[model samples]
Target: MKLALRKIRLLVHLLHGMWVVATRFPKATVQQRDALNRAWSLRFLQLAGMRLVVHNDAARLDEGVLVVSNHISWIDIYVINAWRPTRFVSKAEVRQWPVVGWLAEQLGTVFLQREKRSDAKRIMHELADHLVAGHAICVFPEGTTSDGRELLPFHANLFQATVSASRPVQPICLYYEDAHGNQSTAPAYIDDLSLGESLDALLRGAPLTAHVYVCDPLAPGAERRVLAAEAQAAVQQALDRLQPVTARPAREAVGVQPPEPRVDVPHASHAGDAPAANGPLTQ
Candidate 1:
């Protein structure tokens, strides 16, 4: 029954989305467009049973900056847009995702063809132009999703755009968790999975909490490699700080012997994600 409701909700959303794509986009201003996009994206998550939590060093991000984040799932874009209205630098294939693709094109997503190395140079200039025009652009520098397990080495080439635009780059770390506050695999969208297959995984019992950690922004500099490495480390450290606690071996749980003690970061309090439901999968 939950799955049936999910399918019904998606059909309604796609119909409304198509109407927006055909009618509203032709006449909306940039602000108007993003406002509408934000509304839809947030509601889309709610209806899909995903809860969003945003924690940023600053109260809100500036309009024209570069956001670097680890890729996890297609919903990652919406989770960010739920807080900040921005464009994305995505691969060319996302532009082919039927109804969703058309909406993304209208929302100003820049597409990159990874097969052509020169395309990266072209996209760098394109992103820089957008930044110069005061648009926030996001890039998944790892070039692929790791299902929230590892931080892949960032492709430094994308950072060149931030340098060219002289825009500050901010790193955000994300993970999805079930009701029990542990990492959940229900939404993992990796490896040969079709969109329909992914949606099926996401539509199970309840919503998932999207854990977001926003770090301080890095000043753009000439060395893209150094910038990339710094951003990677910031996210890795954030992941370490936020990852779920692991249980000790079976013997320790049974109290046959004392378990090895561990140290943890000391803080008076932590800002945790608000309520959201989740099933069991990975993306």
Candidate 2:
């Protein structure tokens, strides 16, 4: 009965979100769009039956900025949304997933083909446009989800878009705990377990709790490599603070390291290069 009610609530929120997007599509300003997006996001979390603990220090919730965080379970999406209005930088494959794909598209997520460098450039350009237009973007720089036991090295290249746009980037950390009050690293990655298996585990398990902490946004003038490193370190610190004592060492081992900037290319010239635009997807 509880599950059915959750589904019904989710459907209603989605429907309302779609209607708002459709009606405001032509004339909505960036701030208005963000307001609507945040409203829908809050409703979505309410429907999902997840609790959120956020540490946000930003002057404005709707400001344009890049958010980098440690990736954990699929529920990380809901966890982050519970804090503020935001979109994600997801892999192209997510667009093909059944329900998730549709929802991601509706949320105006930035999609990329990581294997193709050029496609990444194009995606970065699109992301910059959204940022410039006052939208917040969340990126999981670990490139893949990890067990809550350890933080992964972030791909510095992912920072290209925000660096180019000269936008502020906020670092966030997420931690999930099982019912026993112990952290379970096994359920972090969706690929590690089949969708059914993952769902079953969650259903049979005690209610999980997620912790999110948002740090100060990096200044615009910081170097991309430096920015990435600093963001990684910030997230690691947050994770360390929340993680169990036994897991601390492993998480710290993989935590942030300063990335060496690529010296071959001229940094300034490549920073804001615009790529060929693609047809805009419907919101």
Query: At residue 163, what lDDT does model 2 achieve?
Result: 73
lDDT of 2 by residue, 250-275 (tens): 34435433222211111112211111
TM-score of each: 0.83, 0.74
Output the number of the TM-score-best candidate. Answer: 1
RMSD of 1: 8.2
- How accurate locally, in lDDT, is each candidate? 0.69, 0.62
- Which candidate number would show the highest lDDT if scored against the true structure? 1
